[model samples]
Target: MLCQLEDDWTLFTLVFAVALLVPRSPLRFCGLVAALYVLWPAFRFRQAPPWNARQVIRPAGDTGSPMVSVIAHRGGGHDAPENTVAAIREASKNGASGVELDVGFTADGVAVLMHDDTVDRTTDGSGELSQMSFFQLAKLDAAAKHRLRDAFAGEKVPTLEEAVEECLKLGLTIYFDVKGHADQAAAVLKELYMKHPALYDTSVVCSFEPRVIYRMRQADPDVVTALTHRPWSLSRFGDGIPRFSSLWRHRWATLMDVLLDWAHHHLLWRLCGTSAILVQKDSISPDYVQYWARKRVALVAWTVNTAVEKQYYQDVLHVNYMTDSLLGDCDAHY
Candidate 1:
């Protein structure tokens, strides 16, 4: 972790470090308890050696076969209520390769499938999700106010365990976006990992927090952990600059989208020990990807929803994986 943590994990640490400081805790891991109500994620996929059997991309137009899994972002948010079971099951039926959803703890400490702290966007309920109990949350509608009502008027907010069982039944893989604080979130993931070993194989813990990723990596390096990034996260590494221009204004724009450079290599060598990073490919320019690749950083893009986006990642950008909203479009098998 980039930030140092206390040696002991305790209630004091929870009260002072997480609650009073950092500030993001209350918004992320909502509720708290000693059991199932305590919110969390699973560490199953991390057990696999991700780099062991990397697949080389087949040439384009292998006639667009339905080979690899298509990952639906938040239950393919465009088509249904984001994160609802109906939405996820819908994704499975659509032949999606897998589903991607964000999770956060509720006010009472139970982990739930939620992308935000406030429920106003996706539910009839208002205020923070952390403020409610499971029964109270269940009473509110999970359906958003789009064309998806009526069919999903009574969808209950899904618990992490419930989501896992449903996904298991569909025989699908998942990439879990654990959006929260470092240690607490890790604690939650650890709890789930102990409960379900099988879920770890096809799941990954993703976040913008390097500390969170590092902690999870330390606990279980085999689990797949992808680092989300804002431009600031790349700054110290040195190669992250130069996005001050548009692609037309930028130099070396052929492919890889250049996010790092020779300067970055020297920069990362001084700090990170290694230049290779697990990053979301969508946020950066092709030039940025080229820059990071030059620094030996492995790239993975997010929310790839169209053929053009797919082409950008596969044919033009050549990233490690294109995390898309649909399963049939992507081909990351390893």
Candidate 2:
């Protein structure tokens, strides 16, 4: 009900702004009609189903420390070249218990570390990662665009196996942020977990795509999994007004997006069998954390950086959190 009110109020403000700009009666009336059309559905909006509030199963062999776990986001991107070997080492050196890295596949089906669909942003290359072979990708400098390029230049993109090896050697937990190519990535992760049983204790596989988390659980039920979610308002529309849709098709799509966002918060855990929920810091509240905690579902917050944010999630909420900064009051907790 509150969500609908917020939406309607936003639409009303937009309509008022349009009224000020248009002196003519016909255009202003059209704008008013469009606003009313969009706002009418708010009164008929149905609430999402309540959370069932069942006990959540903790992943097997996950005997991690009880203290708040400080996960390094993208291998602490603020410290070193993200998703590279140097970043992994730097994160471990800064006392991070675990390092998160994004995983994607090459054209030849080899799993590698990459956040974006294309290599153009992070590497000295231009192409979709899934279209380039491992050999071709290895030649490009992964750290070319980083702020500390001079210190970390010539760093090559590390294969998934190579990244696991480095994390194992450093005794840092591995948090694989599965970006795409789930089937191939799942196969590789299953192989690694089977060969190196320690990963079952030291690693977690997480994704915003529920299908990827589901696939990981199916392939290796013992592999720890976390469902990543950010509300649609933040994820899709940010602070801007929702895009105006004249056609019914686009309006229906928008309604579905709203429903899905509600499901992510209220129902996704039951459907996906995730052991933990990785949510954006702003989307979480003390009550939200307590609800999941009672159900034995761990809550992991992401990309928290400031001292105030760190203190709230750690000291007040007592939930695990990931951060881009490794050295500060945040790392002290680790």
Query: Candidate 2: misplaced stretches above 4 Å?
Result: 1-65, 233-253, 329-334
Per-residue accuracy of model 2 over 1-334 as CA lDDT, tens digit each: 4533544465557567867687768876787778676655542212111221111122223565356778889898878888999999999999887888999889998888998899998889999998999999999998898878899999999998899999999988888899766787788899988888778777888898877876776787667777787665432444334544456655675677786776665555655556678887877898988866664567889878888988887799877789987776333111
| lDDT for model 1 | 0.58
Give the number of the best model, judged by lDDT.
Answer: 2
* Per-residue accuracy of model 1 over 1-334 as CA lDDT, tens digit each: 2211121123234445444455455545344322212321232122235342122111122566423335677777666677878878988888665677777787677778988888888788888877778778878788855356877777878988888778878866666677776676777777777677765565667665556666666665555565554343432222455644566544444122334332233322222222134444435677877865553445555656667776666566665343434534443211
**TM-score attained by model 2:** 0.75
Model 1 bad stretches (over 4 Å)? 1-48, 51-69, 232-298, 318-334
After TM-score superposition, what is the CA distance of residue 108 in candidate 2 from its true location, in Å? 0.6
TM-score of 1: 0.62
Q: How many clashes show up in model 2?
A: 0
